[model samples]
Target chain A: MNIKVLFFGILEEIASTHEIIFSDIHDIKALEKILNNQFPDLTRYKYLISVNHEIVKNNALLKDKDEIALLPPFAGG
Target chain B: MNSKFLVSGAIQLEIVTKSIASHSNKLNIGAHSVFLGQVRNDVINRKKVRAIDYSCYQEMADKQFQKIKDMIFNKYNDLTCMHIKHSVGQVKAGEISLFVFVSSGHRIQAFKACEETVNLIKDEVPIWGKELFDDNTYNWKENK
Candidate 1:
């Protein structure tokens, strides 16, 4: 299953890119581990994970073509 | 024209004026509330802030705007109309970045809806602002 991952705010700066594709990732926890291993700085800051535009409080199961986003603390007015 | 949610640059005074004038003919709207958010010029580490470069997750932002508008209207059924516009690109310090307009039959409803809309947008919107300093440095803004 191909999954699309998105990075926003400071997370985007740490990831060095806005998006990436992952294959074989079964859940958010697994995705986190892989991303942490690849981009160690990403683990330093707190962020929220959203699966298919919905914020997930816990590990969420990922499906094919699912879009995942890592959101930093929002700074809007 | 840009979408209803995101404006490409600073919210123009003319647009705000037009928005208010457009509702003038509606005899039922006895009250109109307007909220404007301006970019602050701050000195961080002795560097002055030049502008704010705003960005967001567009697809999700649109969804959140719709949700907020629907909820606000449902709660204040007497509201005649509501409009929201937020800046997306570089907005200089001292310029308007956010605008919320609400019109209702009574003063209470318009005031309440406008305040709630501004607060909710600040918290729930997926927008991010990078504070660009005059000394070629930057930091992220923290909403208070």
Candidate 2:
């Protein structure tokens, strides 16, 4: 299975890109572990995880073509 | 249902004035509440702020704004109209970056809705600001 992960705001700088593709990720927890291993800097920041545009508070099952986003704190007015 | 909310750069004064002038035709609306968010000049890490470069996750932001509109309209049945515009690019300090206008049949509803709308935007939208300083360093802005 393939998943597309998007990083926004300061995560974009920390990840060094906007989005990335991963393989063999089955669930949100697995994906989180992979991200922590690859981009350790991400562990320091607080953010919300969204799967396919809906914010998820807990681990969610992932399928092929899922678009997961790491959204940091909002600063809008 | 209006999705176009991102405006490039600073929101000009004329835009606000023209929006108000155009609402004259809506005779039923007795109260108009407006909110403008200006970029503030602050000293960060011993450097003076120069400007703010705003960025957003456009697709999600639009959907979130629509959801907020729905909530607002449902909560305030007397609301006649609501308009919002936010900056997407660099805006100098002291320039206008956000414009929110709400119209209603009474002043209290308009005021309450306007304040709530602004708070929702701040808390929900997927927008970020990078504060550029005089010495060329930048820091991400955090909402309080």
Q: TM-score for every candidate vs. truth?
A: 0.97, 0.96
Clash list (residue pairs), candidate 2? none
Q: Where is model 1 more than 4 Å wrong at Cα?
A: none
Question: Lowest-lDDT window of 10 residues in candidate 2 chain B?
Answer: B1-10
lDDT of 1 at A22: 95
lDDT of 2 by residue, B27-140 (tens): 999999999999999888788888999998888888888888789999999999998888998999999999989999999999999999999999998999999998788999
Candidate 1 lDDT over B46-92, as tens digits, reads 88889999999988888888899999999998899999999998999
Candidate 1 CAPRI category: high
- Indicate the fraction of true inter-chain contacts that candidate 2 also forms: 0.85
True contacts kept of each: 0.73, 0.85
Q: Write the per-residue lDDT of candidate 2 for residues A1-77, one digit (tens) a residue.
A: 89999999999999999999998999999999999999999999999998888899998999999999999999886
**fnat, candidate 1?**
0.73
